[model samples]
Target: MAKEYTVTPWEVHGDVDYNEIVKEFGTKEIDDSLLKKIEKYGKLHHFLRRKHFFAHRDLDIILKDYDKGKKFYLYTGRSPSGPIHLGHMIPWMFTKWLQDTFDAPLLFQIPDEEKFLFKNNLTMEESEKWATDNILDIIALGFDHKKTSIFKNTEYAKTMYPVAVEISKRITLSKAKAVFGYTNETNIGSIFYTAMQSVPAFLPSIREGEPTNCLIPYAIDQDPHFRITRDVAPKLGYPKPASINCKFLPSLKGDSKMSSSINETCIYAGDSPEEVSSKIRKYAFSGGRDTLKEHRKKGGNPNIDVAYQWLTYFEEDDKKLEQVYHAYKSGELLSGELKEICIETINKFLSTHQKARAKAESKVEKFMLRD
Candidate 1:
């Protein structure tokens, strides 16, 4: 029997099937018509074309508001249990594109309290440290300093708690358990954390005393949390936040999503070029035949190849990507060469990002949301 797969906000295991996940999550696929609608508002991002960001909720409605001169803000977050990995970058990269295209304000949350509640090894102090480190990475993405406001949930609790209480009133414990698979074993803080997550979606609207639409770009695993948020938005007289969901970036070992818990299977933002190359060369699961001669004869399967899959996210040029695809399928490009390409591409990205991250270290104060 095929191993059963599981996906949750706290844990992701087994290989995910995006098609099945979309159906299960009650999200609509981003179709051509919707793509055209989005293009009307802003440039169609390559992530949309490649289906990395494949599903959405109320995306059309958000655009409709934009057409009528109502603007939306961006909200997406990180749980700072550990250092961030390349997989963590996927949503933020797309978020940056959306921010630039729409010229939107962004609320970047580092939910350290959530991480502290969930991860056993992490203390509040440790989570705070990770949150600080994570903020540096977020700033490194080149978000507009003037419009971007970042806050660690614990640090800005004075501002976040009041709104979170209103959200908490609407969400029942039964609903939380059903959505998050919580049992009696779950702690009170963990249960209350969802309310904090929901606050950013409707926060700007609350502050503005008008309907400010929110667009949350995130992985599909996070859909359940926002589903609860959407449920309560109308009760509070705020518009339901719209979301664009992306598929999880595959692990180097060809398992489920790239995870911070599993160090060997993930490529971190801070990894040196040599470490990135070594990980890809040693750990990346290939879809080629065991023997080189056999691989040449039968060719490799890009569908199952980790290197090829990473390229979909990294390689933006359609023609160039197609060329690499054809070469691999025709046995003209060997596994080592493919790994080398992925390594080179990742290293190039890191070189620029690391420099930005270093600069961002000195600029963290500029992005924080104050009480």
Candidate 2:
């Protein structure tokens, strides 16, 4: 039986079966044929080669439109509730590759309001602070300011609210309830939020005063919101937005959440080497045998090892990653040894990233989209 799992905009957990998700969500799998087509434009990103971004809705159409000399833009965003973690970066990194590869403009939305409405204790001001913090990390990823427009939903309300109003008109209460599983007690703000999420898909067309194609690169949990966006696009004289969806990065604790407050559950992009080391050594689930003798004889299971799984997301050197995988499976690398490599890799990445984030502080105004 497939493992019990859930994928919603607010929550993602369990041993998610992507194949089942694609079937249930009515999305097309990102097959080799699609990969080959994408590879022709430029070198295929590892997210595609590794199949981390494994499902799509009309991705082929986006490419075909590009070939016909009708350009498309990219749209993706974050709901800034807390510190950005490694799991959150999975789709952003892929979205960065998409922006670079296509030379396309990006509508990067930071929907601060979503979190405030969803989290009872999180105030609007707190969410806005997190949005600013999240934007710095996103900028650190090297997304071009010229091609990227980052906006917090509240600050961009003048432009977004009117568009959201149009979208809200078409989506009935029953549709919202059915799509999101909303209950009687679900707040008015939360119910109306999907329309706000849908606004960016129509932004380009409205801005250019012409029909525009949009491609959204996002994680699978965010797919339901886009399903509604795509449904309403055609009626509004815009092409349905195409999307490529990625899998979540697993927690250090294995099948669980990466709460920002818990150092052991997830690795924040801003974490220091000591914190990273502690988390990996103390919490990262191991696939090795319990005893040294048993480990040497039976070897390790790299497939289930949390440290090795993280490498699949962050370790870009294909040959080196393969070496580590085989070394662990053959017992040449013990669980501690594998965790050490992971710790080193993450710390190296963050050292460079933190410096870039610091520099991004001066460049925020250049990227922000406002009145």
lDDT of 1 by residue, 1-371 (tens): 55378878978887687888888889899999999888875667889988899999999998888888888999999989889898999999999999998889999988888878987888998888888889989899889999899998877889889999999999999999999989999999999999999999988988899888999999988888999999999988999999999989999999879988888899999999999999999999998788889889989888899998998888888888898898898888899999999999889888899999999978888899867
Give the Cα-based TM-score of candidate 2 against the true structure. 0.97
Question: Candidate 2 clash total?
Answer: 0
Per-prediction TM-score, please? 0.97, 0.97
RMSD per prediction, one decimal?
1.3, 1.3
Give the poorly placed runs of model 2, Cα more than 4 Å off: 1-3
Per-residue error at 98 for model 2, in Å? 1.0
